[model samples]
Target: MNQTQLNRMKDGLGFIAALDQSGGSSPKALARYGIKEDSWKDEDEMFDLMHAMRTRMIKSPSFNADRILAAILFEQTMDRTIDGLYTADYLWEKEGIVPILKVDKGLAPLEDGVQLMKPIPDLQKTLDHAKERHIFGTKMRSVIKEANPEGIKKIVDQQFEIGKQIAAAGLVPILEPEVDIRIPDKEKAEELLLKDIEENLKKLPADTKLMFKLSIPTKPGFYSELMKDPHIVRVVALSGGYSREEANQMLSQNSGLIASFSRALSEGLNVAQSEEEFDQTLADSIESIYQASIK
Candidate 1:
């Protein structure tokens, strides 16, 4: 992240994504990662996590500079039954806040049994569902990640359909292309993939935010092609899976904004005994991201 990037992050929309789980893994994963509470099984524990998460956000004051503060969500993880969705600022037509609902494979059919990894048609359905249900962020919704070029096209195609239908309803489609950088060399692959993204974005909604999730061989060069596109809104570098520093560095490089996961979720792994644990996490997440915004 650079000074300019820092400015952009502090001044624009940003978020930390959440897991999309529909299994025991939901609770177990949060716990395994130490981000959950023993009360994960107990209502009090669930509420505690929620309180901590939200308090953290408030303390962080993410919206102070007009930045979008939120827990991004994937289809599998959007199950509100647990402590996840209740803390959302945008649920049910609320204002100045909203959860970034991640449109995962669940919205679209795929070759695999899993919904989190497949491609979906139009992400508008999720946005609409949020509105009908009065979920916050009533005016917008964002999507992330398609494994490859084909997946990118699938996502853009859906956004295009929604774009054409905006008069009837509206949603913001975010294209998250998970970039697996080839440390030593893989320019050809990088170019090939970024090219597809550039071309697709040209035909999608003008409001669409394109994010590049790059890990190794860190540099904007990996996404050199896409970054050059006039419409690309943000380029985020993520190492995924457990390295909070990786994400922080990615955001810190530009002094950009980041969404914490591994560590936040890790709280659940320690077997939270009660609500206090959950409350503390939320309060921490909000503060953590706030710091990122200022960094």
Candidate 2:
């Protein structure tokens, strides 16, 4: 790999805090902190609450950016200014943390009613916006709840297709096809998922660079082959509803997997806590997740 690519990969180490939860997930999450969506009654009111939450989330990395490589943000949070600095600018210029954008619209039904993220109809427009904001990369998510070969293939192909577009626009794509951990044949599903990824990756240009936001494998070291490919900037594990402790334990056994966790990263963070307490809790979360990531 060239020096630029090497540095990009190295900088991707440690935890990537996922602060991008759209639609139902966003309001539902805020409800946990007593900021109910239904009570807001208007987009502006709801956005006010969300902006408050984003401020706190961004502040978590203020004192120590060592354990956090980047943060993935929702479009709503991306443009907002915090204390006169845009959200992305605040993270990168002030905290030295890379800022990534979540580019996919939420899931829609595919064949057999299988859920997949609808294509970003104006993805290039979004990338153009991201470029103006100085965002570092992009992330999109799809789910594989069953080991259906046809569905898996479609998911992988679509993810790669869009990933290539993202790369062409000069931003790294974190292709996340998350397999539900509740699936019974997790090992089989994982094997097939890797197979699909490998097949698609082989057809891409030799210099294409990307990242993988994967679920914790049923077995440790399941991603060793992926790690050998230099074009893969990082292989970040998603918590998939696991508790922070559970996620950390699973990540600790994996050789080259780090985290890009949303729920798990914010498991203990709440609005009720004092500012000092919140910062401490977030710092502790980063430290624990970081240790496991590099294990």
Candidate 3:
């Protein structure tokens, strides 16, 4: 593991940029960027456009280490190049931002009020490649739609089991068991989630550290205890479906948790904008999230 990168992640004052939208989510991301379904002919071209958007975001002046601690990338993005350097290398070498890869295949069908991650076949190979390309860590996600104790426990167990494998491969793992923000019993679900994650943290190996990406809780500071856990490197909040203004407002109420936003971070950016307009929009987004993170 890169100790310096780990330390930065643990103590950094900024937020993580979630640029890892996969095939399932890329169309919506592209559409939001002012590209529609008619623009791309097939899957490959679709992904290429998505990559172009990510590349543009990374190359922007505001997407630097000062207010951006790290970026979570899709596997293809990690494999691609930015200005002649591999994506991960460019992030760390040129911009001083750490790079983390999204390793989950996506989610399984919702069962028992939760959706576990789909199996990641040949995960070891992916981890090995991430290390070779200068990746500092990995992020995987599962979702909880209600307060089912059994389902939440299963999700946490699977995440920690996979997290152990990631740790064994010499990379930190950000285990995201995101509770649905719109669920009727959101607070109950978060309560159950907190218990399950706490139990798993107790069982984790002494040397294995983990990060968490969760929905902003219904109750402010609800995750404060988790932030203090010795085995937890950091606890971050996902924007889930919140608007940038809403997400930032909630994030500022949680003193210790930082942001790891996808759509919210890209909200206002569109392909039609001029280069100057695009950069200014991105800079504004970064600044708002950065201020919320430091609160």
**Which candidate wins on lDDT?**
3
Indicate whether candidate 1 or candidate 2 has the larger TM-score. 2
For model 3, name the residue pairs that clash: none
lDDT of 1 by residue, 139-177 (tens): 112223324445445544544444344323533334443
Give the Å shift of residue 43 in candidate 2.
Answer: 3.2
Candidate 3 clash figure, as a count: 0
Give per-model CA RMSD: 7.5, 2.2, 0.6
Clashing pairs in 2: none
Among the numbered candidates, top TM-score falls to 3
- Residue 293 in model 1: lDDT: 34
Better of 1 and 2 by lDDT: 2
Task: Give residue 65's error in model 3 in angstroms.
Answer: 0.6
Best-to-worst ranking by lDDT = 3, 2, 1
For model 2, how does the per-residue alpha-carbon lDDT over 1-295 read when each residue is reduced to its tens digit? 1244336445656778898977658787787666666768777777777778878877764433677888899887888998899898888788877888999998877563136788688889999999898887899998887887888888898899999999998889999999889888778888988999999888989989899999999988999899778678888999998999999999999987888888887777778889888888878887888899888
Tell me the deviation in Å of residue 61 in model 3: 0.9
